[model samples]
Target: MNEESNSKGIAMDLLQHFEDILESDPLIDELGFIHPSQFDLLNEESGISCNSFDEANCQSTDKILSEQSSKQENVYFWNKDHKLGISTHILLPLYKDAKHSFLTALKRYKTCSNQSNKDGDCLPASSSCDLESLLMRHSRSLLLLSCDFMTAWNSRKLVVSKKKQHSMFLNELILSGLVLSYSPKSEQAWNHRRWVIKSISAISSNLKDILEKESELVEKIAERSKMNYRAWNHRCWLISYMTREQVIDELKKSRSWAELHVADNCCFHYRSQLMLKIMKDSSCLVETVSFSHMVDIDKAWKDELDWNGTLIKRYVGREALWLYRRFISSCWINHFLTDSGDASHHFKESITNYHDFGTFLKKELCLIDYCSTVVDNEFGDFEAQAMHSASYLLWLKVKVPKPLENELLEKMRVIELKTLVEKSYPERSSLFNYFMS
Candidate 1:
């Protein structure tokens, strides 16, 4: 009974050992594991034949060979789960020996990486941690997700010597979506490409080379999806990342491209956003139209009042028109309230269309003589505050000469002095309230 019980115990231990091996073995291409390409270095280059064998051991040897081949394939694809070949087979014996050590390192390293990111070290590190870079101090959490355990280990060995390559691995790991965001893998891929371009070392790679490669990536993605805001945003980021002259040149080139494709608002909106970003960053607003040929609003209609009438009749009923009017008002307030940009041109555009709230108010004030209507009485004071506020800002901007430069200041001063004296109505107090605010 003792011997039988001992035999059963030995069998159970063997069973448990097999189970552990099965669990530890790397995954085979099953389920959602779609292998996009199969260029395994070992499988392609090594000419060792696993097919031929004697009859006695043929079946077992075939199974072993197949498993070994699969493992080899996995390692070379590194992006795929694979084990090292014969040279590293010795390490397999040590796997059990070092299991606890490996697990401890993995846990400690992952925690350290999370802390680093939480500490906001990723931004500065991102410049050096890019795809194709062969050197980075730490792989961070990237090592945990890489399918090729041995390759990942080898890559880490190069961390100190080949900084660029290490960075590149991190970049690839990110693009591979083994780290960073997983839900949007493609986004991570594109971002990784951008990061890699931006990470080019000044010692190893020319700045122009990096900028060109990034521009090419941007154009490639932009061409693939012209409406991709992310691509456009990346392009803008790349341009901003480049030299000052490069930024301006890129802006000019992209602006031309944007204007050529005016059939859709996506490009228009992209151009506007890019221009806004540039203006915000440089604090240099381009007042004059980049393109020489202007769309004549006067020629579009017969007269200024006719243009306003046409605009109101055509678009006043639209919700988009109301939203647009609000947007124009907001833009004016944000961009031109303190007369930050071209004051005259901004006001001219705002007041050009009757659908514009300010223009609408101008006509209404002339008719109402600042008196409250029945609707105003019901709504409690008309809340015509938006219109009144915008008019007063325009008035104050005109009154303040310090906000303007020589040419624009002189031009606006004449306009402001003329309007201030000419318009003396009861609602003039509303202008004072706006100025104070």
Candidate 2:
């Protein structure tokens, strides 16, 4: 019983200490869990005894604050500058403390709510605010330990919704972001951020800045953690809140990152989402769009097509680039070809009528033929390249206007498409045959 009591005391003390550290330094943006031995080694190297922080707890507040400021200059215990490090030794204890405190507060809040409902009168304003503050504080630590704690998350939503303060909503963003600092892929954390954004949007006019920062956060997180779908998904979701100019700027800004990471489809998917937003905005315009604006949007689409082709050739065998092309091409056909008015077709061959469509088909066929005949090395990247090209052409044939199908098939007949596909990807031959028939 003594050991259990000591453990509970230590755990709560650690949890309280962590909370204090956060309160003192709210700028802590990154979190890492280091083994306790590492903390000991750092302390030993610095000629400070271990357990110094524990001892400082009993000191006068002034002394503890002075020591904390002093400690900030060193690599630091618990926190340094903009990052927080937690020792593995205390994680279990801290988690238990946090979970216990959270559940206790949550139970109390719910019971009070039930009583208020039963009595048909609201709780006193002071009492309600106190319970909410208690619940929020406890849940913050609990979620840091276990991000998927659904009830804890839902409780926060309940509290934040009732208060509806803009600053409180932003605090929710910070809390969710902290959870993301450790767990970049936490669906609940990401969802909480989206909820906060939506709840705050009704009263917040500075959403453009918020959306920009959210996008930057995703990119920063993505840099550290590769291929994070949730991060990219969050970025894509920000598109809905962006203006048309912001959407275009994002597309241009991602160009360099996309070039550096030819294989990461998430960034490309983000680009595609931006492009789709542009298309949707153009289609749903409240007034007639200017000819110059239409030309600018058209140039943007053509530029994307050209850029994708460059990457395909430069980074051969990249299926992601090829898949992105499929989406872009289909959108081009649907928007520029079938949906364009007669005037659009007349300007610089811009509307891309059947004539411009024919030019596109020829360019694509030339591309596939060139890819299929590429010289190879032992890596067989060329083989994969040929496979992608064959499949892409075959896929494109089906997606083309029905009148062009026979023309595409006739053009393909001269290229030995079956033999080209069979050499690298025989499984898709049946698909080709299906399309051919």
Candidate 3:
């Protein structure tokens, strides 16, 4: 044989010898893993003879297969002292199995550093597919593989590979605690998982994607908890990572859904807080429909606000009152600005006429006040604090404008007087007085 062919044959014989040793070792029956480094020592020291094999040209699948089957018998032998060995000729099938074994082994091996080494199996169907597409298709599966039981313990510990560590940590956490467990028993695996999730850097785009996924996870958590407070708390924390505007919009939608389904005052109290958060964040950002729907909740609710001790009673009332207060505050300010400038004519058509502020406030404002007081008395909760603050500021601003002050004060007095009369008179009788006043 040529000298090159002779060297290759020797390499193949040494590989076969390492495999034979693994098969003969009694540990393979129980542990199911063999250290690669141990295989390296057998290659250097065994001095096995070979007639036909090439170490550099690992092109013959038949040869690789013959070698693999011969070595398969010795799977559990360990030679930790030998430097890690690079296999010369690997059969495709055996290579895949070895990758899986390595992944499994690394899970048990603490501090395995070369996680990407096992990823050779995860490459494309052929040589043409790029790395990005390969990862996209197999990220989750590969992540699971890398974090398999006992794999981390057996593999070379990699401290420098941040990306691999991230994958490992994520998989560990997900399988540990983020998922619903049938057994109420907590595991160290779960605590470690949470640590990894928390340690994820906020600046990373991948972390952002994970944060989005976390919303779905929180929803799942809520399902497991039956809409419990702990689930809601986690949901809120996840939402906090998103933009304020988006978070509030999502919260508003969630609150509406919550109000529709949840009948407890405490739950409604939570919804009210969510609404109040949106208003406090930026009242102007609130949509007209959400705004109008809130203020006119009874109108939206069709007198459901008056029902006896319903959770909706208190929450709807508070929301309506808050909306009314905010609407008037906005209106008063707009009108005061118009009256101060050349734009005073805009109100001549709407204000003095009962169609604008006069009749609207007479009916709506009274209802809002009654509901506000009902919320205070029944649930002892107040959502009008922001609106109240806005109104207080507006009140101070309009003190110097006599016409604006007089008009708003008169409207306020009428609302109060009508509310008092409603408490004393029959419903229809109060309606007649409300229409007359």
Best by TM-score: 2
Residues 1-437, candidate 2, lDDT per residue (tens digit)? 66567657756777787777777777778777776447656556656554454432111121122123332222223565567777664577788889999999999999999988898646787988788888998998889889999999999999889878998998888888988999999999999999999898888766887888898899888988899999999899888888998998899889999999888999999999999899788766614676567778888888998999989989989999999999999988777766444233344254443236666777788888888875866767888899889888878877988876777777777688888878757776666667777
- As a TM-score, model 1 comes out at 0.32
- Determine which window of 10 residues in candidate 1 has minimal summed lDDT: 54-63
Per-prediction TM-score? 0.32, 0.86, 0.32
Instruction: Candidate 2: list runs displaced more than 4 Å.
Output: 41-77, 113-128, 339-355, 406-418, 427-434
Candidate 1 vs candidate 2, TM-score winner: 2
lDDT of each: 0.38, 0.79, 0.38
Candidate 1 lDDT over 27-56, as tens digits, reads: 321112213132233334453222432211
| Residue-level lDDT for 158 in candidate 3 | 33
Among the numbered candidates, top lDDT falls to 2
Q: RMSD in angstroms, all models?
A: 16.1, 5.7, 19.6
